[model samples]
Target: MTVADVQLFVTSAVGGAMVGETVEGIARYPINLRYPQSWRDSPQALRQLPILTPMKQQITLADVADVKVSTGPSMLKTENARPTSWIYIDARDRDMVSVVHDLQKAIAEKVQLKPGTSVAFSGQFELLERANHKLKLMVPMTLMIIFVLLYLAFRRVGEALLIISSVPFALVGGIWLLWWMGFHLSVATGTGFIALAGVAAEFGVVMLMYLRHAIEAEPSLNNPQTFSEQKLDEALYHGRGPARAPESDDGGGDYRWSAADSVWNGSRFRGDEPDCRADDWRHDHRAFAIAVYYPGGI
Candidate 1:
């Protein structure tokens, strides 16, 4: 900003859309930096000489917001430039609309109202701050809803706790990954957090579902007619137990199928359990095989 002879330093294509290299080459034809050019009829090739290096990083629409133009604003304030002639005020801290309003006032009141080019801007801090606050409120409520869902899906409180606790850990890992990749936490980052939450709970849901299926099949546990300790430890912590546990019916001599071993195989859950003369409920392998491992178990 030049006050006396300050012709207000202006770069035509600094942030404008019309600043293309091809267009500039065409506009500045017969271009010579150090040497005189003998203009030929053919289009002039730009003479190579090092001048000022420009910043070439691209800024996307997602990274910017709030661009406004006002009717009232000043370009140059005084007729003759003085020490106090140049005014660069951060009027945004006040009534934001007034920032532009003040600029408009300057132009209307100033002597040099015929100034050529002035300022260009994109994005606003206040608007971004407000939007971010709204999302912060939304994030916690969403996390709470997920916690309720986990609690309802798994009857035990401990199971829900385990799943919910992992939420922060997973998010931290994701943030670290994105940060290392040169990405900042922005509006898209909120979406990423939501995606991670669902994925983390998916594993917890599958584990709980498998445990439920095994519990319903065990006859020796808490069945329609029996209450025994045969499946006490296995049901408490499933899939991690011993391979060949005592089958519930024949007092430590009966063989049984493990659900976890054959979950993907489809052979363990063959068919409905068969009943005996005594009406004792048991995991019948004959029925199990036909039902679980039927024709081409998919």
Candidate 2:
């Protein structure tokens, strides 16, 4: 029999109802023509089904083609007009970047693809690559904006550059801490470094402001010709004195000039008065900067 005849008959007899009819005052009923289930239960039974050729010759279905069971994919899948297969992997106890890197190396060394075949990596690794690319551009732009703002605030290239320089120091400290904790660099950590740059710039500006005020308070140290190490130290010593004297029983207090007070409220010296001969301001400045910037005691 012809292929079309076989298909038409098989669809009508086995697939489903070929059509439906409606009767007045009655629901629609389907018109179907199928053999009893027992008559077509196995391949052997199917092979015995009768077929009428155009020449009016009677024959069995087995005379046309072989019939047997086989195995295949339940459904076909394709990508870009080509068949495709999917393999999923999950990483454990390792960073995504390193895991993907090792996977790529192993695939390249061992897995062989036939002609016209290609493999692509995606998912989180794809997102990471995109983020890293944007960060490369964003980080430099962020630094440039910060430098411009610093220059506008201080109105001096030297002072702006000085504040901008502190960002690298803060970044180094952040990187060191990450390394110590065995953490990988990611979008979250990069964002944190951006925040760190802002904080470092703020601290640098405050420190610079206090140092300038200290120099301006002393005439001899203000001038470049008479500015000496000893005179500068004397200015810092007085500039970093307690912000306010101890309150008296009458609820009254005296205000004192203090650089550390700009950062820490109610900061005081070791005693009622600062010892000029000692280098206490240096220590206090370091301690205050550390305490303010790294409250966790880094």
Candidate 3:
């Protein structure tokens, strides 16, 4: 691990769990070969052997020697790589330190060189990680609050949940759009995402609110019409079985009558039918109308 140590960092990687974040395979070749001092003077002489330098320049190893590369006939004839060979020499005396230094330089020269080793995770990384966790947690909780708000505001659980679920696509789109704009999501972007969640829900909420009403408003022969209590009882009984004359309008003139076989619903002001008492019609019609129109007290 000192200046006298010659290491060959071997260098390719396929894939692994951390494959995307890390240099595929962390590799290094360490050797202790030393050469005659004569080869240091001439670039041609240096290039003559299996030495591979990133740039072909004369190198001195008073305390450290440089790595060189050869991709010519001599190296090919030497049965190195098909047409190239990687070469390095050791500088004696505490060569480990020098070797590490030279290796650093070598890595700098190799384009797209992935790091071969790791010391430890950085504090910045940990900080960002904690931020990420908080953001993840906040996303769901914020969504939950929005859902609750929707429920309270709309007075219907189904429509509220639907609005909350719709926010994810908005979130995803915001993320992608930010990426397209080259905005690395930092603290500011995290805040923006929260805002986007609310905004996104509005998209669904606006539509959802209107949609529920539209659906509810659909004609229902089942839907009850309001009527005066006088005919209300009459309508209820006659509904069970028909044939009843319309009573005095109660002076209200609101005696529009629709009969369900079981009940007059809103009007049964007066009549002679079994169980067809006036009370039955008025009570059932009002109750049924209330149940249908604003059920859930909505």
Pick the lDDT winner.
2
Model 1 C-alpha lDDT per residue in residues 37-128, reported as the tens digit of each score: 33211222221211232354443222222223457545545433432244445532253334655666777678353355344222443454
Each prediction's TM-score versus the true structure: 0.33, 0.59, 0.32
Q: Give candidate 1 misplaced runs (Cα > 4 Å).
A: 1-124, 212-298
User: In candidate 1, residue 227 scores what lDDT?
Assistant: 52
Give the residue spans of candidate 3 off by over 4 A. Answer: 1-123, 215-298
- lDDT per residue, candidate 2, 136-212, as tens digits? 99989998999999999989997788767656654565565455555567666676567556755665665566556
lDDT of model number 2: 0.61
Q: Give candidate 2 misplaced runs (Cα > 4 Å).
A: 1-75, 224-226, 234-298
Which candidate number would show the highest TM-score if scored against the true structure? 2
Cα error, residue 62 of model 2, in Å, equals: 8.2
For candidate 1, the lDDT comes to 0.42
lDDT of 2 at 90: 77
TM-score of candidate 1 against the unseen true structure = 0.33
